[model samples]
Target: MVQDSPATRARILAAAVEEFSAHGLAGARIDRIAEAAVANKSSIYVYFGNKEKLFAAAMDRVIGDLSDAVPLTEHDLPNYAGRMFDYVVDHPEALRMSMWRHLERPSAGPVVTELYERKLEAMASEAHPSGLPPMDLLVLVVGLSGAWLTSSRDLLAAEGGDPYSAERLATHRAAMVEAARRVVDGV
Candidate 1:
């Protein structure tokens, strides 16, 4: 049987997130995850299936944390983007995981789809006044908040500035909020 302990599962998930974030699904090794988690490889397979499933579980856990920590509303799109921005900044690997999933997985799993459904429904209810479809607005909010975290280095290089400067981060964050506001206003 699997280790079947919450401690072991949590450890594996933590290790898996780090591994998958650093190397992605194909490059991540089950042996490395097991070593990092202080569990055996067999235990990981039993608890989390193959490497793909482990990656999915890790993504799901973090996404759930974000959903709980940053619920969205179309009326408060800017603040919603700000919260998402903060969360993505604190956990940049989550964005990396998302990008890797899009590249590596053919389609999202049912659980991930369900999470989107709930958020879309909530946004749709409030988005009628904004005149933009909920999906479009949702994409804008997440993309605006996360775009900097994912591409700041290249952007900074083009601007001839430090990518990790506090000033840069602050300016980008404020811009994200303004962009979100404009997206709503434009609609």
Candidate 2:
């Protein structure tokens, strides 16, 4: 029997996240993941069934972590977008993973779908509702939050500045927050 320990599983997950983020689903290799994780290939199979399943599991973890990292709030949504930008700044791999998922994954977990649904339901229940349509707020917030990472090159060139400049990063984050706030505050 292939007894998978929590430690081993975690290592595999960590390695898988890096691998998938770097290479997406098609380019990711089981051997590379196994080597980086220091776990056997059979163990990976036993734990996650296959590379696709491993990818799913890793993405599931990412969404779950994001849910915790940026929980929905009754107060300022701009703050929420700011928080997301801050998070992405620190965890760019999450953004890469999301990009890869969107591009390479034809479908994703119901858990992520349900998470979005829950957010939509929450927005629907807001007392001072933004009046945005279903999932629009969520979509807008995500797009605004990630725009910096996706558009750094263009933004840098347009702004005539270094991408890594602290001022530029702060400015980008502020814009993301303001954009989200506008969307949420809009009808």
Candidate 3:
């Protein structure tokens, strides 16, 4: 329970995020994090215990930042999806960090579970009343966004494909809205 100054703590956390996101727990280096934070290694260890804990904390902060960027709301589904896609594109680092975590089985920790549960609650509140369960709605939301974020590169490389191109994104946005409508309408 060391009460570090906010500025120092924020810098360490930011640096840790970049390090852990770029290199998983096994590959991440405390020296690099310290350098990036402009703080000594001792401070990082004192604040976060160890590299594993720091990685988890960094991930948690990323999740918090994302929640702030896209506060959950009872909005239309397609609009929500569009916002999610836009956020991921804008914050590519966060997306990459998350993907790295998924790749590295850090732990089945409560922080991740709670983050997901919050997402589920928001999705359930916004889901179309097609009798779809909360989990299903959650899956749909995550699945669509995950597909877009993870596959955007490959999708773009496809012939005549350009996922980030204005026209393609717009079309995808429209299709997502229509899909939501159909799901909700039970069509």
lDDT of 1: 0.80
TM-scores, one per candidate: 0.83, 0.83, 0.75
**Could you tell me which 10 consecutive residues in candidate 3 have the lowest summed lDDT?**
105-114
Per-residue lDDT for 70-162 in model 1, tens only?
A: 776646878989988888778877677778878987454325667678877876666355587888877877788888877756665998868
Clashes of 2: 0
lDDT of 2 at 103: 91
Model 1, which residues run further than 4 Å from truth?
1-4, 106-130
Please provide, for model 2 over 5-87, each residue's C-alpha lDDT reduced to its tens digit, 9 standing for 90 to 100: 99898999999988988898999999999999999898899889999999988887776677689776635678877888888
Give the Å shift of residue 182 in candidate 1.
1.5
lDDT of 3 by residue, 78-185 (tens): 566667777877787678777777778545123556766876677566645667786676567656765655775655677575667877777776777667556645
Ordering by TM-score: 1, 2, 3
Task: In candidate 1, list every pair of residues with a backbone clash.
Answer: none
Runs of candidate 2 with Cα error greater than 4 angstroms are 1-4, 125-131, 152-155
Clashes of each: 0, 0, 0
Predicted structure with the largest lDDT when compared to the true one: 1
What are the runs in model 3 whose C-alpha is more than 4 Å off? 1-5, 106-129, 160-162, 165-168
| Prediction 2 TM-score vs. true | 0.83
